[model samples]
Target: MRVAAFLCEALTRGTTHAEPLAVEGNRLDFVDTLRQLQPDLVINLCESLAADSRGEILIPGLLDLLGLPYTGSSALSLGLALHKPKAKELLRARGISTPAFAVVQRPEDVKAVDLPYPLIVKPAHEDASMGVDFDSVVHTPAELARAAIAVLSTFHQPALVEQFIQGREIYVPLLGNAPRRALPLTEIHFGQAFENRPNIVSYKAKWETESPECRDSTSALCRLEDTALEERLIQTAVGAFSALDCQDYGRVDLRVSAEGVPYVIDINPNCDLHPGAGFAKAAAAAGIDYPALANRLVEIALERTHGNPSHRTKGPGTARRVDPPNRNVLAGRGPVRHRAGGPRAHAE
Candidate 1:
């Protein structure tokens, strides 16, 4: 099988995100390579091109145009997931317990917010914890205005001000299509250094391994004694995943309140898949190793395209010939705020 592991340059070597896709495959660092050496399947790890996350859907959009099957969510799903506010709106509409949020399209728009304070302000259309820090959690209107203004000026997008849910942070990873199941859940335990800081996962905690924020925030497989509560959390996660129309695999991040209610914080359809990431670790807990997980993604894509995954499991899978075409005009980010009675964005 000629499988191409599509990834960005920073994820090429010696990185946590690079190790999961070490399965037998060709390493494609550029879209041109994808055009020249067409493969049977693609394990898309390239979150973005040209260092802009807005370009995350460009490659997948191209593959879709060329009728090439790839792993994870589609271009439309990626674009929808990239916008935090819009995603939350859909979740709320589906009766999913998400924090109340207000979108600040401009700095002055902050005054229109009616949600309770101690809101977490972040860039409207970004992932990987971009533009999120301790200061993002504001308790006063003045602080909210300042944070929203900073996010607007920095990310050139609206600021999503969501109610800050303080509780146990949990992440649930889901896989497959017809019968999607939740992997072992992970709980983020903030250490002593986090005593004075908000418990939210910031960009520094995610991208900077050496930083105090990253070092102090730890993740462990959750252990629950209440079976009913555990069941509730699983149902919530699955409901949110289904609501988003996430395909192949995705992760749902939530915070368990003091009353044991789970609130959906974020739904990442194209989340990190490195061997050390929470998703892979959860898969490992279920006895599916990284190599097998990677291969399973390929098989899922093949199954969705051909209706049978059994044949693809054998080595050297047959490739459907596809002619290269002109690049797609990438789909940009959707509207920052959902208009009243306007169409909603769903999983593709």
Candidate 2:
């Protein structure tokens, strides 16, 4: 909410007011609210609808039906992105590197897996590390079956089993269109909380504020001196972004293999935008202040809007070749924040 206020104020130049519209569950009410408010533009910070992650893929379709211009990716891209395996297929089709993997809706389905061991399994249709935990990183067929079964039963979705890339977990956020700019790269550093455990961001590490995994995990400005490697990382993420036809702003997550090859691990459209999160941190590292980022993204979307009022922006990712700028580096410890009192709820 505070972040919204900053954006509202920043965009208020030459305007009356800008605000956020909160939609809980009532679909009609949301549509009616939009009809009434008739917002000039929408930032599309919605992460989900009615507490369901998949529901997020529908919001843009609604906005488009009402002929509204908005920030972020289109509904089609969102659909491909939410389904992890589908996004990987698109990436591979583009000749981009992603982990080798398979899907399983039933325990026995794991038998068809030809990939090597030490695979990570998670709910195929979910995001935000929702069905992932210590057991997600499995090494044996029995463990793989248990993990796949857990996802099938708990999340009621097919399980995605991919070869686990053991190395650095990096996030690349790209903003704008025609020339999408990749922000400073950010890396997740695992602390003692992950000792002897896989360096994956489990459900607890991400959302359970009180958990040790959350406590010890930190997001820091990735300091890679190898200009060539950095370029590869950014271009790989950009490749994934374009393959999905994502627009405005989005993030691509990758895990560098032990052999130093960066592989796309996740494509997060409409990724977290809280000031304390990775996207905002990368923006800040790029010398883009919070309000500036808020304002700039609006301009990006508005540019696409005025350029073609009727046509939805869709094309191969237009990447601007940008060189990295010096960063604050989160003072070396990384920009780590936590919800102090209790666990942050994972759902609506």
Candidate 3:
């Protein structure tokens, strides 16, 4: 079936604009472009785009208006997942284990917060380790404040200060919904460099593909021997994914402590799905090849669309939809409210 791949110009910049590519320089045009193509399905790989432009909102709304099926989580899930603080708060309330964190909008905000040192600081809304690096680990309150200010000034957003979990970095890829399948567990091997720098996936390690410091710092390795441990990891990964209402496929990053206790570090809804990316690698380990995996996602989207009859329409209408409020507004003020029988007591 034909698929419309919607990606932001920020991601496509400096890249070749070849066929099968519809580049929307501004995210506002995403819906209009999708309307023009009217493909059978839409693969939303547009994480780098601005959230306020309602880039997240427009996707699902467009699909609903046009009665088209699409891959990945719905717009509500996308908005919740994009806001780190809100996601963490929701997860915490659900009793899903996550790193303890404090949101910092300004340098002075760090003063009242009470998280431990060697704290990790990052842009609250950014993913793919945008402002995270070795310097993100701060030991002193002053250093933490400085890092928070730097991230806010650079990314123009609030900073998330979280307790740094020191242990093995593990990633579990989850697919399907009714009976979610967690692929093989992938570990980040720091190797000898851990002696010098202590293993952590910094921003440079992720974005700078050719940086020697990163090259020497990290590696993704799978194939674990312990069946019981693997089972536990998979269960925890699935729990976290479901807790966040993530759909289709996604990856959950966790850190296992010395006692084998896993803490959810991050839940990625629209993770990198390139054939060479971690998600694909993990799927391959689970016996789902790249093309098969992609097709499976399409099938899942169609199933969801068919089940939700009210969500379908013949074509895009002129109905205008308003954007939802920023998640920060809710999370920044106080503790988030949860429905009854919240957070399940899962391992991670």
Candidate 4:
């Protein structure tokens, strides 16, 4: 089947994270060319548009209106995943463990946090460690207020002040939808440089490739000596993924405490799919190469939308899965601007 890879041009500029030349390559007119070619399916690699993550769902939404099939989650799922607080509320309601979090829209709102100290503050709707740093984890109310203010003033979004989970960071990548299977657990290894820093994936550690933090913060397939604990982590991750209503392939990030309890931190449906990314790395550990993984994503989308491809191969993408909007409180609307202590609200 003819396939088109959709990517954002914003990543190439103002960030050393991903090589624009390599990611964009010769597909400069990728979107336009995609419209011209009208491929059988789309492999969405575009995390955002013009550096704004809110635009991540726009392309997929367009594809839906165009009556096209695409890999990964739907437009609604992407929106829900981008906003951290909304996703957390969904997980907590599912009986899955997520750190208690309060969204601070103003600097003074930080004082309203009823959760414990040593909270990690982050931009409410960003991914890939954006607006996160070592200083984001605060030990006192003053530091939390400063961090939340910084996030509010800089990113111009509400700050998500969550209880900092001091434990091992585990990443779980799930494939398929109905009978989704979790890949081998991957752990972020904070190297020697992080001995003095908090064990969290900060912005510098994730984006600044040449920085020591980036060099030291790494991911490796975790080896679980206890099979029961391993199964529990996988089950928790799967539960979190299902709670968010993610489709196709997605990754769930969790933090395991000293007591061996796992807390879901983030659910990324349109996570980085680079061959070197955590999702692909976990897939590789499970014997699924990049090509196979890509094909499998397409296969899953096809199976869900068109039923068995063998029987419905003749159609012009007539059979499509109509994803009904989730009616839950955390349903798709926009970035939820979480209140300090009251009802959860969102911002664009």
Candidate 5:
């Protein structure tokens, strides 16, 4: 609700109108509505379709079919980022640093996992830490099997088991294209409540606000003690963003090892833009307030209409989908923002 309202406010900042257009199901209805409405632009905030995370990729694909210019990453990028193993592979292919990870389909599959014991287990296809919990971080073989099985059964997806980097967890928000600027870094702060707890941003830590995990963990602007590590963090984050083919705006999450090496933990395209989101906080740190950040995203998408991937993807007929003089209110799909970890299930 806040995501759509804020985006609408931002779109209307310059006389352009925007409105929330939630799709409660029925793809045909959604399609017919967009065609009839023929919106000049769409500020897409949806990370899923019909409550299914995998369906998020189809949202952009649907918008493209309607020939409407929408803000954020493309269908291909969203798909890659939503599937953990695929995104990690792309990062590795680009020579980017990501924690060693394996996909486990069953409890027995944990045996084939050659990674270290102090690893994190999570739903391979879930976002917003939907299936992640304090138990997700395991230190023993038994713990690993339990965690993997929990994710596999609960989320109905394979489990992603990976080495858990022990260090600072940082979030780098990227805005714009060609230059894809990285905003000031933000890190998750653990308070006294986390004293005896494992220092990890679990699902409860990110979403269950009333829970101790969430209360103990807070997101704040962070400056690395070592300036050099800061730069590497930014560079590696940008590399991950580019490797995932994210556009307009996104967030790259990382856990810097004690050795100061930054490992790409997750790449989120079309990241949450709520005023209180991590991406928004980083943007605010860089002097791009929520409203201006929203404005910039719309402008970035518009700027790409000339021979860019967006334009080419729109194809010839979709050219008419550009900002027409009769452009009505910019429609949007709301309630897709991740209010917890703050992503498109953002890694905390």
Candidate 6:
């Protein structure tokens, strides 16, 4: 079956050099291109969309409009996962352990939310460590406020002020259902001096590939952990996944406190799938190579489409059922409403 990958042009740039047949474009162009191709499956790897600009939900809605079968979580799930504060609230409400966080729209808003310091400030709506830096960990409320404002102004979004958990940073990759398999846990090990600074996967640490802070400080060390603790991490990660309603494949980032309790920092529904990325690395650890992983995602999408291809096969006279208005023709004003035991008349 023919497969089309929908990803941002920026991500697809280097990819074409290795895979000459890969089609790449910006989000809108990519959607149009995919429509023209009409491929059996579309792998959506585009991180952010224009609708995400103002926090408007777009991903799943667009896919529905396109009537295309695509891999990963639906638009509702993606939108929910993208907003960190909302995601955390949902997880917390569901009895899942997550880092305590406060949302800050302005610098002054920081004082109202009394979270402990050495707090971490990050763009509330961004992922991939965007707008996070070494200075994101603030030891004082004033500094926290300043960092929050900087993030809000720079990223044009609210700031997530969270209590920084200093401990082992672990990422749990998950795949499939009925019995979801958690791949080997990957840890971020920072050297001694950097220990004072909370083990943060900051924006600089993530994006600035050539920065000295990264070169001199952190390392992504996999295959290093005790068996019992590793099992706990996987269990907690799975709990977070179920709590968030994440589907297909994704990754959950966590920090194990000194006491060994795993606190979820983030749940990524549409994580990076590049061969060099963390998700792919974890899949490799589970003995599923890059191509096999990609194909599995496609398989999941096809399964979903098989159940509901109405969106894909839409045509004239294909209109589905709709509930009629709540009014009785005989009454002319309103319909009789039922309240458990009896029917009652309601005015228009």
The candidate that achieves the highest TM-score relative to the unseen native structure: 5
Cα-based TM-score, every candidate: 0.81, 0.86, 0.78, 0.80, 0.90, 0.76
TM-score leaderboard ranking: 5, 2, 1, 4, 3, 6
Q: For residues 239-311, what per-residue lDDT tens digits would candidate 2 score against the true structure?
A: 8999999988878988988777999988888776666677877888899987788767766776787663223
Tens digits of lDDT, candidate 6, 211-289:
5445444435356446787888888889888877877888888888899888999888866665666777677777888
- Model 4 residue 162 lDDT score: 94
Error of 2 at 332 (Å): 36
- Residue pairs that clash (backbone atoms under 3 angstroms), model 4: 336-346, 337-345, 337-346
- Give candidate 3 misplaced runs (Cα > 4 Å): 1-23, 27-30, 50-57, 192-194, 221-228, 307-348
lDDT of each: 0.71, 0.76, 0.64, 0.70, 0.78, 0.63
Give the alpha carbon lDDT tens digit for every residue of 96-158 in model 5: 999999999877898999997689998888777677776888999989988888887887889
Positional deviation of 306 in candidate 5, in angstroms?
Answer: 3.1
- Model 3: lowest-lDDT 10 consecutive positions: 327-336
Which of the predicted structures, 3 or 4, would earn the higher lDDT when compared with the native?
A: 4
Error of 2 at 120 (Å): 0.2
List clash counts for every candidate, in order: 1, 0, 1, 3, 2, 1
lDDT of 4 by residue, 63-91 (tens): 78766667778888888888888988888
Could you list the CA RMSD of all candidates, in the order they appear?
Answer: 9.2, 8.6, 11.2, 10.2, 4.1, 15.6
- Please report how far candidate 6 places residue 34 from its true position, in Å: 3.7
Q: Candidate 6: what lDDT?
A: 0.63
Highest-lDDT candidate: 5
Per-residue alpha-carbon lDDT of candidate 1 for residues 105-183, written as tens digits (9 for 90 to 100): 9878988999987799999888767788899999999999999999999889999989999899888888888778889
Error of 2 at 229 (Å): 0.7
lDDT of 4 at 37: 47
Prediction 3 global C-alpha lDDT: 0.64
